[model samples]
Target: MIAVRHIGPPRLTAGLEGAGRLDWDAHRRLHPEPAPLTCEGLVALAEEGRLHGRGGAAFPFARKVRAVAGSAARRRGRAVVVVNGTEGEPGSAKDKVLLRRAPHLVLDGAALAATALGAGEIVLGVADEGSAASLESAVAERGLAARARVVRLPERFITGEGGALVRGINGRRPIPPGRKVRAATRGVGGRPTLLSNAETYAQLAVLAGLGPRRYAGVGTPAEPGTVLLTVTGSARFPAVVETPAGAPLGHLLDLCGARAGEGVLVGGYHGAWITGEAAVRAGVSRAGLAAAGGTLGAGIVMPLGRGTCPLGECARVARYLAAESAGQCGPCRLGLPDIAGALAALAEGRDTGAAADTVRRAVRMAAGRGACSHPDGTGRFVLSALEVFAADVARHAAEGGCGRPVRGVLPAETAARLRLEVDWSRCDGHGLCADILRGLVRMDEYNYPVIPDEPIPARLEGDARRAVAACPGLALRLVPRS
Candidate 1:
């Protein structure tokens, strides 16, 4: 039998609720005392408990704290604390749940982290209006009006990144630059900033209330303390599950009423697909998942149901990811659509050799050509799909069809936005769109234009327009942005 423990607020639920209000007094109870406000103290505390960031990348919290503390102390510059509540991953709701239901817990964590690092300010950046409002109201109720402020951000996936959030708070658009930058090194008005996801802050709050030893009491030796996972798909008890870091996946599925035999997709769409829950049961920590060739990206567990077509689902998600690209890089701008097209053709009982070749070439071209992880992540999603669903690929190759409909198991809106619609009746197969768009659009063996399912970059507007103009059948046009 599975176990469920409700932490923090009493009203927290498994489903997405719109901007639920929080009670600061009740929420503050989650943290009994303020955290130690020094780098040495915080690091020692974190190291003692072996706490890691709750975000997808489970880097040690002590290391991150040390980095900011050492730098800020050396430069005599203020260290800023940012609570990252953007939660941009399509299928994630854990951060949003924390912010909406227990905002004060997150604030306590941020405030404690700020005090520890000797930071002068705290900024909570949220992408959703509901989450932002809940946080803002909580801050006001806690009388932390002077110490912490909430900033509402535009809703874009990349904007939720640590660097992107820093840039957005600095009055810039929330898009990542081509080069890599760490928020802790220079973030939030150019200060030595300690930025982490909302759940990370909440964990800090928990640590503050419970001493390191006590916090370490519940989890594994390698990683201690509870983790929050947003579980869904083929699971009966799907919700924001709070369990020890190395909890068994089979136990979680049993608690959630999920079948034990089906394949599981750990992490979100950008995450890898695992064939069995036993792999998860053996270990569920970041390191454990990594050893299994999967990273717990965003802590989303989606089980492929017994009758679901894995390839069909993958194709659906690939198309969605292709559309989510920021449209700034050469390969992503051109390569993702080719990948999506190939998958779509393969799914629809068509010969996909040319399309598959395009996908391979595009994946290579897009590997490191983007400003953000958008291209890399999209490529990873597709490549993983191809590998995991090799049997399906073979079937498609032999029969030109998978004999399965593209079920909308992935997020629908995102999938719809990623699909490119072409009027076949008007197509003359002149392949002008492919000729003019080059890397972004290509002609398959059938001489039809295979366009990527992503947004066209402003940089490629000239070529895209030319392609549309050259279409003899007037069958090509850009899809309206959602």
Candidate 2:
């Protein structure tokens, strides 16, 4: 299970003293609910506190509110509020922890936003069944069964994208459409929608309770808030911790028990890697990470500890990320796999100089050319790996091996292998598994199972299990490759 805790003094996580999920009564007893605020008041407070989204994009929260309101006015329709708790990145679990431990906190924010937006409904899209169940119970406790409904989204890397989440709520394929579709202007049920991740809403709840001045007291002047981060990897300390925005990254590294081996991957797979020294000089906020040549995308910090092959680890994640492509955009379809293959060649000491050049070129070709921002984020991740691990690349170029085995310190689809199989004895030509496991399993001329010999990528594990459960014939099975 994911551990939940806080560093320094906890503000956003003040109510999380207990390990189990806090019920509404216990939640209100520990953290009293805030007095309701008007839309103008809420927007003004967000602006004054400079509250930005905790999602990877870090968009201004106030702007999102105004955009939704303005779109509603123009279109003559009511607004919709969406709380995205997918947290599809394997390295990130802060949202999940918040939902599991502090569902009321998130609901408070969503309820506040709904009241301000004049919206009739709230759609909470979650990554797993547990979070969905917790939220469903919380909604019932609040007597908001009519206003709020929880949906368990298909677990996938790109499923967390705003447009994609909206699609899933609309009962469409949960993938980013092959073009831009702003949720603020036209979203759920074809109405203006305000969409943001779970942490952003929780931050809003804290801001509403504390008001502007008190909310701005702890963090930096421009960025005032305590951000929740999923800190894990070779450090061996895996927990979701709440920290002030501009807190020193080195202090956190030591607090989290980092071995300080190679470097840290900030912002999960879509974020860049920073050198150990860079991390030491940096803070946990966006500007600080940017100064240190990294971005605080999605609030994830992962340190590469001693004895693991950093180059090999990067290549493994690169391949997993490549496998996460939605395949709707050309850059994601072609460039990602090419970049992954080139990085693997460099890691395997096949042709380091040429492979490095190929990775660089592929990254450029992929970024800014996707249907969504997935390609751009992947480019940032791969490019940062090349820059931070330059010495390792040079060494691997000179020698055939780095002499250290890849410990799989970083979490990704390649961490393990899973197989998809079908039992012919109970087999019927149902073809349900084939439809769900799209790119992996297929049906042939007779419309029966034609399972591939390839291993299931960990990113697709949820879909694999769903396929097994959905099989009418009960012939499908997914097992770990032994």
Candidate 3:
């Protein structure tokens, strides 16, 4: 039986009360007696504590701070700080929780970072209105109106990316552009910027309070500090957890009431799949997870329930991610949907080899081909599913059916509502739609249009319109978004 533990303080737990709030001082106290912010000092403290980004990249805080400091000193330009509260990865709720419950902690971290980097301004960007309001109110209450500003951003999945957030702050659409743009070099009105996740800032606040030695005392030597994780899937308690880095995944699974038999999806929808609870023995640190061919992406640990078919779940998630694509890059815009469709075909037990081939080709084609890591992340997700669930693929291949329904394990309201209808009576098998919409609408071995699971992009507007116009059978019509 799975065991569950109701852990951590409640979301609205009082600010910095007792041991839990050791790092946080009341806004009034902190504001009135603001400490000097220094780059060398903060770097020494962070390096001593061995602080890392909690956003799952696990990039060293000292390195990132030093980069900004070095650049600022060289260029003779002031630095700017951005606290990213746009927790776009659906399953990761830790940042939102921190902003809502301990806004001051996040602010403190940002202030320390701003002072360290010699930043003139600090901006906190939030995805939801509630988080924005919470941060805004906290800033006002703390009398930090001059130092910090909170901006509410549209809640698109990719908008949470550092560069995208920077663009949105500069009055551009939240969509990622076609080229690479690092927020550190040019960001927030073309100033050098330091951006990190909200939880990262909070942890920095903790480091500031406890110093490096005290902070490193809790977690592993390699990655010393506590990390907040949002545990979901079949776990009984799906609350945000604050545990030491390098904690065993098994311990986390045990806390979440996860059963042993089912595979676990670490890192949320765009994360990897580990085959059993035994795989949970892998360390939760970034390097540790990466060594296991998985990542602690956004600190989301979702356990796939036993009853659900893993392949089906993967297809659903692939479809959702495809839809969420920024639609800028050619391969991601074209390839991901094909991959999703191929997975769907395999799930339905139709032309299994062909579907697998399509997925393989799409994965190869889409990897690292986007302005953001969305395609690469989604490709990793799909490839990990194939690796971890080899038996499921074989079963589908042999039986031409899985004997299980495709239960929606992935949370995508938009993709769930999208239906690709085939009017067999109208489909003359002319295959023109398949020809024109090559990436999205492909031909199955049997000559039917295999619509891959992804959002139709505006770039495909001309092609889709052409395909609809030229369909000899008049069987294809693009469905309007509801």
Top candidate by lDDT: 2
Q: What is the lDDT of residue 474 in candidate 3?
A: 80
Runs with alpha carbons beyond 4 Å of true place in candidate 3: 1-34, 414-424, 451-474, 478-482
Candidate 3 local distance difference test against the native: 0.75
Q: What shift in Å separates residue 96 of candidate 3 from its native position after superposition?
A: 1.0
> How do the residues 256-323 of candidate 3 rate in per-residue lDDT, one tens digit apiece?
77763557778776788877744566887787777766788888888877777778878877867777
Candidate 1: list runs displaced more than 4 Å.
1-22, 260-262, 277-280, 353-361, 415-426, 436-441, 450-473, 477-482
Against the reference, the lDDT scores of all candidates come to: 0.71, 0.84, 0.75
Q: Kindly give the stretch of ten consecutive residues in candidate 3 with the minimal lDDT sum.
A: 1-10
Q: TM-scores of the models, in the given order?
A: 0.87, 0.87, 0.88
Question: Tens digits of per-residue lDDT for model 1 on 209-279?
Answer: 77888777776777777777777766666666776777777777766777644367778876887766444
Q: How many clashes (backbone atoms < 3 Å, residues ≥3 apart in a chain or on different chains) does model 1 have? A: 8
Which candidate tops TM-score?
Answer: 3
By lDDT, the candidates rank as 2, 3, 1
> Where does candidate 1 clash, by residue pair?
37-115, 37-116, 38-116, 237-256, 334-440, 337-452, 337-453, 349-400
Quality of model 1 by C-alpha lDDT: 0.71
Q: How many pairs collide in each candidate, listed in order?
A: 8, 0, 1
Backbone clashes (count) for model 2 = 0
Lowest lDDT block of 10, candidate 1: 9-18
